[model samples]
Target: MANHLDLEEQEQLDQFKHFWKQYGNAITWVLIAVLGSFAAWNGYQWWSKRQAEQASAMYEEVERLIGTGDLVASTRAFDDMKQRFPSVFYTQQSGLNLAKAAYLSGKPDVAKTALTWVAGSKADTGLAALAKVRHAGLLIESKEFDEAGKLLSTDFPSEFGGLVADKRGDLALSQGKSDDAAQRFNEALKLLPQQDQYRRLVEVKLAALGSTEAK
Candidate 1:
């Protein structure tokens, strides 16, 4: 009876060994791949967090420099922020700040340059459209009416369509294209909500052009 029990135990051990021999390599590889992927995902999450923290600190420095009216320092900080975190919200915000600072510092060309980059960047479509509108206005200030019109003609976010139309009207008026200006002003009026405060301003513009809203 002891020998019979021993033989049964040996048979069970042999079965386990056979199963291991058949599946051990595949199981080992699967576990290795899964663990490797998990490690990579965790490492990426940590790296992204660290990058965001550093970028936030630098962006704070940019704000401080801007508050102090140090254009050079602000510009430098903005450059650093853009270089390090171009996809971050702060990077796009810094572009706006840089444009405003350049304009206030009597550098219209620099302001236009910054705005143009923001306008054309693929970071955020909404921000890009707004930047294009502002950049167009700056071009108008430079007496580049045709260029301004071209910029305005470029597509924008739907929400900005009214504002862009109004700016185009202004550019047309400045160019002495009265008929074109009236057409654009009409389009802008249609886009503005009836109860909007700015709608009254558009009405005034239409009145000035000897045109009245229909219906």
Candidate 2:
């Protein structure tokens, strides 16, 4: 009976050894891959959080400078934000703020430069379209008529299509295309939703151009 029990134990031990020999490497590799992936994901989240926190703090600084009406300092801070955190939301906001200050301070060229960058950047498409519209307006004011027309011609997001049409009207008028301007203004009026407050402004533009809605 003792001999039979010893043989049973040896058989069990041999089975375990066979399993290890067949699957041990595969199991070990699977565990290593899972652990490595988990660590990589955790590291990425930590880095993203750190970047957002740092960007938020810098945006606050830019906002404070803007509140003080320090256009020069605000410009510097905005430039720094653009350089250090170019892909972040705060950088785009800072660019817009700085453009406003520059334009209000009678620096139209500077305002146009900043706005043009935002418009052409790989930032959110909606905001980029808004920048393009504003930049076109500034160009019109500067009498860069042809360039303004080109800016207005670029495709924008759907929500801004009406706004783009309205700006195109302005550009057409500047180019002495009053008939074309009237047509664009009429199109803008129709594109705007009934409840949109901005629709009234477009109506006024149409009226100024001596155009009425289609009967």
lDDT per residue for candidate 1 within 49-135, as digits (tens), equals 887788778878888898898887888888778778877666676788789888988988878877887886787888888788889
Q: Estimate each model's TM-score.
A: 0.76, 0.84
Clashing pairs in 1: none
The TM-score leader among the candidates is 2
lDDT (CA) per prediction: 0.83, 0.85
Q: Model 1: which ten-residue window has the lowest total lDDT?
A: 86-95
